[model samples]
Target: MELPTALYLPGDDGGFTATPLTIGPWDVTLQHAGPPAALLLREAERVSGIEGGQTVRLAYDICGPVPVGPVRVRGSVVRPGRRVELVETVLEVGERPLMRLSAWRMRTRADDPAAAVARDAEPHPAPLEPAGSRPEVPAFFTTDVAYHRALEWRFAEGSFNAPGPATAWTRTRSELVAGEPMTPLQHLLVMTDAASGISAALDWNTATFANVDLGVALHRPPRGEWLGMAARTVLGGTGAAQCFAVLFDEAGPIGRSSQSLFVEPRAQA
Candidate 1:
């Protein structure tokens, strides 16, 4: 099968058309949360009047399944300040909103002494090299899924079939939008939503653990195309589940990501 060129194609009227590259393993007609989350962040950063600022926190709420078609993006700065600001972005399919993202942008401190303190305090070692890692796709994913084909994955720790924590390095082969290079932040956002799937604690064929919300906090900007995630999922007896991952770059740890899941048994086929 021929792969899509990019996850989205831009329109003249400032809208975007989702490509097959955005398809998730769960549904072919709907988009994976990764692409839409990244798209929301892309628009969030474009809101004017936020100068010399960087997004430190992102909270994305998935309202519903995002359809694979035209989408309208809207962004605004809700709470503005010189040193800090709050921005919000929403993705809509026609008149229905599918996803919303709220971000906190803070002023950059180039010479902050806290940098040194954090460097010394949090000394997370790098994971195994992607080149030498195993390139294995889980049985849960069909070979025809575009999201799996669009990303290169190298497992450094647990396998996808293993019912526990896993560490893997991942990167997208396609750009976020046609003709536009994806930013580092965009790249990170695109992969953050997969934390639960990678670190699933239950069998994919038996259970459905879909994340309703994703939260990310970044201490520093990610560098390089390859991103690593050391992730795990926790399921509670009360029908609540959550996934956590420490975001990494080639250099080292950059941030943390989390997802709140809505767990249920898979429908009998």
Candidate 2:
């Protein structure tokens, strides 16, 4: 199938149409959490009364599977403030809510050399570029899925097929929304949810790990198009798991992201 030009296209009645690029590896009909999470933050940033603030924290809760179709996006300033504010955005298919994002936007002073601290906090320098493009997608993904195709992946440490922790760099080929350029935050959010899939601790052929929520905290905004993540997944005995990643740009460590995952055995075909 020919991929859409963008992940989402604006529609009438304050809605957006999710394109094939939003489809995930788990289901062809359902949209991936990454695109929708970015959409939520995109809409939250556009909420009235919150101009000039930068989102420092983003908490996205996946209420249900977001379908690849028309979706209503609504945003509001739940807790308005002069320096700090809470913005909420919800994506709904008809009356059913698919996801909600609560973002904390804050005002920041101009960069000051004297005010700078923790400049050498985590000395995780960006890894050397991968030798070549990843040759194959995870076995669980169909060859026709557009989401994986929409983003370019280059692994610095482990690969899609390799188990255990992996560090990879990723950037989207398509725009987040048609005609409008995606912001740095949008680019980061669009690839954040894949931390679990790339750094799987369990065998994909045997177990499935789906994240229920994603939380991200950033001390500074990301720069450039490519974002890197050094991620790992930790599974508990009780079928609960968490994926954590130290987010990075070419400069260095920018933030961290964590995902709460629900793990179970993959059903036999």
TM-scores of all predicted structures? 0.93, 0.93
> How many clashes does each candidate structure show, in the order listed?
0, 0
- Tens digits of lDDT, candidate 1, 115-190: 7577657755345877877897766765475666667888999877778988888877888999988888888888
Error of 1 at 109 (Å): 3.5
Candidate 2: tens digits of C-alpha lDDT, residues 47-83: 8465667789999999999888899889999999988
Total backbone collisions, model 1: 0
State the displacement of the C-alpha of residue 3, model 1, in Å, after optimal TM-score superposition.
1.6
lDDT of 2 at 22: 88
Q: Please give the RMSD to the true structure for each candidate, in Å.
A: 1.9, 2.0
Give the Å shift of residue 110 in candidate 2.
1.0
Q: Give residue 143's lDDT in candidate 2 (0 to 100).
A: 48
Which regions of candidate 1 fall more than 4 Å away from where they truly are? Answer: 111-121
